[model samples]
Target chain A: MTSSTSSSPPSSSSSHSPSPSFPPKSHTPATTAAGFIKAIESGSKHLLIKRFTLRYPEQKLKFVGDGYQFDPKRAVGIAGLRGRHILYHDKCTGCQLCAITCEGIAEAIGMVRVDEQWKHNKKAIMPQIDYGKCVFCGLCVDACPFYALFMTNDYELASFTKEHLIYTPAQLAIKPKYSGDVEIKIDDHGASHHG
Target chain B: MADLEDRISESQKMGMQIVKESDDDRLMTLSVGPQHPGSGHFRFIVKLDGDYIVHCDPDPGYVHRGEEKMTEYRNFIQNIPHLERPVIHDSTNITYSYSLAVEELTGIEVPRRGQFIRAIASELNRQVYTLYWLAIYGIFLGHSTMFMWPTGDRELFIDLLEALTGARVTHAFNIPGGVRNDVPDGFKDRCLRQITYYEKRLKEYEDIFYNNPLVRQRTEGVGILTKEDAIRLGVTGSVLRASGVPYDIRKAEPYDVYNEIDFKVQYMKTADSFARAYVPFLDMRESCHILRQLLDKMPEAGEVRAKLQANPRGPPGEAYRRVESGRGALGYYIISDGTPKPYRVKISVGSFRNMLALPHLLVGAKMGDMPVIYWALNYWPVEADR
Candidate 1:
């Protein structure tokens, strides 16, 4: 497919063809006028045509698939790939697997073992996730051997106040009620034990 | 003949005096630098004769972050994201090429779903990139509406992309084996809706800008680059097509889902600035067509990511891959020494290569035509200099 071919006319063809004497005269005035008219006609036709421009924002364009929604009870509640970080306070076991796996130098997560008073147990160590440094990389969730930590699809975590971003063990343990027949218990140990 | 001889004599006399002047006056050399708005990130020293640009020399090395050199240090897996930054707008294309290079080296096969997603992302990026070009071209042509319309419309596509991938601009969607993220729930429906909206809006784009008489007058026959000239200058993409050369990287070298897609390569024989502008408008329509086809034909269930579980760890090898970007054939040449980073990464950016044809295109053109010519070339300094 790759070849070098000489397209130089062999020099003989050049001699055979008659060379123009005056650099080939410019287009005639009649031909120029005709071209202009043709251009104008085509242009006029385009302008006269109907346009389909939607005035957005003022007229809110309804996106398709607003209806026929998936029920949260029937759908698997597993947070998909881009899910935000969540901490399982009870099952944490104080393992720093998530902290070790974070790629960036500026760690967004911190695993501080704070002593907690429980009715059944004398002392319990809980982990806290600092949202300030966390990129929601989901590394910590994967590293937790006890499966105490899991990510949630609820990503509306925006806050004007910086202090509100830092999630404590109590804030991280809040679980929503099941919309359907599925009954799930949110244990104080930060683990979801499904019966 | 007398008038021509008189003008020649005057030019010669002017040239002789300049040549005879002192070293400083011999050539009033001025630098149109590595940080100028009009010149991209490239520096240019132009020797001027009065107001006329006599001779111009381009100096390019400002945003050269030693990408090629950096590649030698990073592993194959890590280089994928690094390579994507050069032409960040065309994320899929860059990452896809890097993937191809890695595949070629390791002989790994990407699954069908992976191929489809790559194509989808690349085409979407192409559409948005074309809008960016159109907006810039609009401003260059003295039509403010064209500029504003495309920029505003671009946000819609960005929103759609954000819905699919977490990030909008730098998706980092494509990795070694396949895309990082699969099409999220309701993604296809959203994409179809956007496509529908784009189809309707394309007509408005034509009426407001392409069909406008002023735009046509300013562009038609302005920079006529013949097919022969295009080939000689090594032009690719829409620039080559504008000159009647039907050479598209997608068609010439069938990569990814491009071979499967039923789309025509847009072309025009005019080879002028108008033709350049026209090619992208036609391309947007083709992109819309391809998007529709992709949605209908995509597999219902399949593996999205590649099975290559291990991240690139060590050693370096060279990989050169090319893809049809919005501007033209974007080529990436990477040299890795089997390390964590690339030893040398050289990006043959589309805009930079296309810009090479500018000085030639702009020579006989008037000063008023500079902006039009600049926009028509569609040069991105960040992509070019990177």
Candidate 2:
């Protein structure tokens, strides 16, 4: 029934009172001029409005919380940027769960044999991540059952060489130092990034 | 090139009366994509007769990576990241339908809060994708200011999304059973505040862009797709709504928490380019209302993800589910052969369906109205090809 009415031209659909008359009441010169004036007025009003662009590199935006984490017992992951992975040496049992998960996804993780022998890690192995191939979906962090893997806010991982993109277990164990404090502040003037 | 020359030479040899030179042939073929500024990553051949388009043939698949075939190699969980890549801006909804289908197959029941949170993320992502589309549509029509305002204001939602799901565009947040994580502390308050401010910004959009005589003059009656033609062409989303069908997948199908939320399917009767453009703006406004409702009705504490086995494999069966994304109704059909990896997967995107209307609508349209008509359809190139 609805299709029958809607399919017909608007002129023939006058029986339906609520249907908006098609051709939209036609634009007269007066209304057209008013529209132009309104558009101009609206555009000019933004001239005094504060610019909202965030100058990156100089003014980095602040993030909430430490980063993304996973609780193996609870079987739920915390929300944050899926940045560089942080490996907990004492917690990771060299199970290769993270590596196994990434194989199907990005194949960014490779379980490498480590020289240091940790009590918890029987195989003396830990996963090394290749950031170049990592899409940062955070499935590897979720695959770690021992709460060993997590993501941090240190996303600025640019390097000069391809070798540097591959972070070994020792490198993954180090917590990155990142301090970005700027955030969006909306005031009467307008919203802008505030440091 | 050789084929064209052969055909012309054959025609000349047959003694067909040629009124003008071959160079002055009435119809001039033009490729409007792959490298064109207006069309993104997609190409279309338009035959122009003077100032009007005589024929239009949309040639999609410049970015096709056989997403369906790629799914056969990965497990269901692994497919989430790459599946969302097609419509990265509206990642949540694209993955939402997949999750719903997977849940149906695997018999994993999502918690109440998880559904609401998923709905909220979907709504937020809808705003994000629509704003991006609007920005591009603005630049397409030479409205630079229109481009800047939406792009800048979109940060509000991006910040909210990054706070909620981690990454900005490629969220990969929605998994098969449910969402990957719970909303962070103070997420509701932050979302509400930004949405309130965003609503105010939307009024400014109406003033400068929608009501502008120039935009209206360029789009009002051009490339009109009547209601019958729209339904016949099988167009979806705002394009379908603009033609007076008023069929929103959210309202009609009511996946997840959509049934709980109260919002009208915003539509227009004219079915012209202006109507197509305006319908999305109205949908965005309605999204704000739906977001508010979802936030309020959301349960305070519940599990965000249903616990699944290390490798979740569904029974041998097929399930199909759809959710309204920024473009239109995005549906996923998955056939699982009692394995972690799907046997066959198919994605039906709104952009692909709406592409049917392009050749239908653009055939008689003016050459200048090409961008206006094309962009107004809310057709994203990569998503269509996927």
Choose the strongest candidate by TM-score. 2
Off by over 4 Å in 1: A1-195, B1-52, B313-317, B336-344
Native-to-model Cα distance after best TM-score fit, residue B26 in candidate 1, in Å: 12
Interface C-alpha RMSD after superposing true interface residues, each candidate, one decimal: 15.4, 5.6
Off by over 4 Å in 2: A1-26, B1-24
TM-scores for the candidates:
0.70, 0.92
Q: Tell me the alpha-carbon RMSD of every candidate.
A: 12.0, 4.6
Note the DockQ of each predicted structure.
0.05, 0.41
Q: Write the per-residue lDDT of candidate 2 for residues B281-369, one digit (tens) a residue.
A: 99899899999999999999989888889889989999999888898889999999998999999999999999889999998888988
Residue B137 lDDT, candidate 1, scale 0-100? 81
What interface RMSD, in Å and to 1 decimal, does model 1 have? 15.4
What clash pairs does model 2 have?
none
lDDT scores for all predictions? 0.62, 0.86
